[model samples]
Target: MLSRISKKNLLVAAGVFVVGSLIGVGLFTFVYAKGISYLGNDPATCANCHVMEGHYDAWLAGSHANVATCNDCHAPHDNIVSKYYVKADNGFWHGLKFTTGQYPENIEIRDSNRAVTNEACLYCHSEFTSDMRMTAGSDQISCTRCHSDVGHRKR
Candidate 1:
């Protein structure tokens, strides 16, 4: 019961198992214990799949494109240290989800991070003295109540 081919196959299988296991364990520990936000640091992170191209394109086209980035606006910048942490954690989670195939692989991608996005939007738009809250009159326009769909759709 000695076959060189069989032995070689066993070794290959073992190697693959080790690699896969390491990846899984690493993601689980990092995400579950720490948080998700280190993966988006790399520009290529979102480009791994083809669907992100649309959002990326829209950003560049918009007026806020040059002034901000995907994170600059989506994430909270209350403090310098906190801002960094959020970005890192968000990136990590994204990487974990995508690598483990937890993401909706075939579905169209949208603004999934609503909390962060809403805060960011308010941060910038709050400064503008415009009619955001639309009530009975044109002057009474609250952005959050009406056009709250800016991030993750107004719930």
Candidate 2:
């Protein structure tokens, strides 16, 4: 029976097997990685990776622990769409880095994330920042420049 099968049929079977195997492995990896946790606002989810343990611990000891979670300070507050967009974008890059073990020893925020964090700072402290914004004119100020440890104080 195998000898009678056409070459085209064998190729089709091999292709299907490869595609199915890839999808199966991908889904298994996702489930094993706790992929769904990334969608929520729970700060504990951020600590799923060992690399984030320090940051999570710091946040627990930091001033913002009583008032904010990781997303509150690191994600955009403009709207739900932008908030999730940043989360998904960051999630993808973080997943890639963690999987490849290619991240820096001392992780630093990217410029785009810094902008989101600055916006978050402004959003929370608008009353205090409004006057400062006006005085600065066209220049934009970075909140983390001076208050970098507010969200992740060293324990």
Candidate 3:
């Protein structure tokens, strides 16, 4: 059997190695994913993953390119906290889906995300849609019902 001191030293060494390895992996992942870019409002940051490339490209060529951006339509615009929360939430889900290779070939918006997008549309086009929305039985109208691919047309 090893001496007590030797066993203690071995345990310490193993602990140190495990901690160092974890830190190294975390650092590498952050750098590889351009983690810093995701903290900003830049639309291109969304394209960090290959899965988002088509959406990014479509937005670039879409009519809203000059007027809006990915975050504007995809994230909550109410405040900084809400915006980043949506970003982080979306990033986590997207990462999980992409990493697991479980995402559908044709990506579809979740109802929750669609709600955010609808809110964004109403925010920007309230002037044009207010009268219509206020009309009888118009509360059920959804901006995306007819404008589903307005921001990013699927290839």
Best by lDDT: 2
CA-RMSD of model 1: 9.4
lDDT, model 3, position 61: 91
Which prediction has more favorable TM-score, 1 or 3?
A: 3
Cα RMSD to the true fold for all candidates: 9.4, 2.4, 2.5
Ranking by lDDT: 2, 3, 1
How would the candidate models be sorted by TM-score, starting from the highest?
A: 2, 3, 1
**In model 3, which runs have C-alpha deviations exceeding 4 angstroms?**
134-139
lDDT of 2 by residue, 1-155 (tens): 46546777999999999999999999998899998889898999999999999999999988999999999999998899999999999999999999999999889899999999988989999989877653256768688888888999643
| Candidate 1: residue 138 Cα off by (Å) | 23
- Write the residue-wise lDDT of candidate 3 on 1-155 in tens digits: 99999999999999999999999998998898898999887999988889889989999999899999888898887898998888889889988898799999888888889889988998888898777553236455567788877998867
Instruction: Provide backbone clash counts, one per model.
Output: 23, 0, 0
Best by TM-score: 2
Alpha carbon lDDT at 58, candidate 1 = 54
Off by over 4 Å in 1: 1-51, 105-112, 129-155
lDDT: worst 10-residue window of model 2: 132-141
TM-score of 3: 0.86
